[model samples]
Target: MKIGIISDSHDNIDAIAKAVEILNNSNVDLTIHLGDIVSPFCFDWFKKLRSDFLGVFGNNDGEVLFLDKKSEGVLHKPPFEVEIDRKEFILMHEPFGIEKLKTQYDYVLYGHLHKVDIRKTDRGCIINPGELCGCLTKKRTMVILNTTDNQTQLITV
Candidate 1:
């Protein structure tokens, strides 16, 4: 299965829209947003995702209740876990929490730092798709992860 990974959109609607188009064209099975989505209005771009989508709240996310209302049934508060195709995934907005359970999940995803990081470990892998907002590092990026073979491709927006 293919999974689309994104984070730190920071209310960049155009970038988010472009990324969604790419992910949809790739025929990803699902998409995961690591956080820093900012405002609830960004959910509109998220709603354009063609596959199943899920997200975790970031430090900047405001109006928790309203964000939930706009999430379209796929937002989790954070430090959430889910098992897919027997692979365990831990999702959060900050990488600090993931440091403690580094080797416990098949895939640990988080954003916060606005930098792309993909590392392999004895147990699994950790990935950060970078800042979709382009506020830092001046690059908007995302990732497509193939669960079957553990191959990841970084997409620059």
Candidate 2:
């Protein structure tokens, strides 16, 4: 399955819109966001863009009540082990937790550093799609993970 992965939008509407359009056109089976949904604007943009957003809570995320209310029916993989297609996947917003989880999952995806990172080991892989909003990085970015073949592509937003 083709999965759209994005992180740390930081309230960039135009970039998010473009990314959403690209993902929708790609006909991805689903989309996973690494959070940093900032505020109401961010939440609204994601809600209007598509329905396949599976995300998590980031450190800078504000408006918890609002986000929670809007996240109903949204499949948010917690900061824990989440299984997809019988393959173990771990999603979180912080990276430090990875040291312990590296051995537990087939893949680990996270955000918060605003940098694109993809690494592998004898056991599994870890991926970060970077900041879609260009928060800390001047280059806006996102990632497309093709689960069918275990490959990932980075796109500049």
- Tens-digit lDDT string for candidate 1 (80-101): 8999768999998887756667
Cα-based TM-score, every candidate: 0.95, 0.89
Please, what's the RMSD in Å of model 2? 1.9
Cα-based lDDT for every prediction: 0.88, 0.78
| Candidate 2 Cα misplacement greater than 4 A, ranges | 48-51, 73-78
Which candidate number would show the highest TM-score if scored against the true structure? Answer: 1
Clash totals for all models, in order?
Answer: 0, 0
Residue clash pairs of candidate 1: none
RMSD of each: 1.2, 1.9
Summing lDDT over every window of 10 consecutive residues in candidate 2, give the lowest-scoring window: 72-81
Which parts of model 1 have CA positions greater than 4 angstroms off? Answer: 97-99
Query: What is the TM-score of candidate 2?
Result: 0.89
Which has the greatest lDDT?
Answer: 1
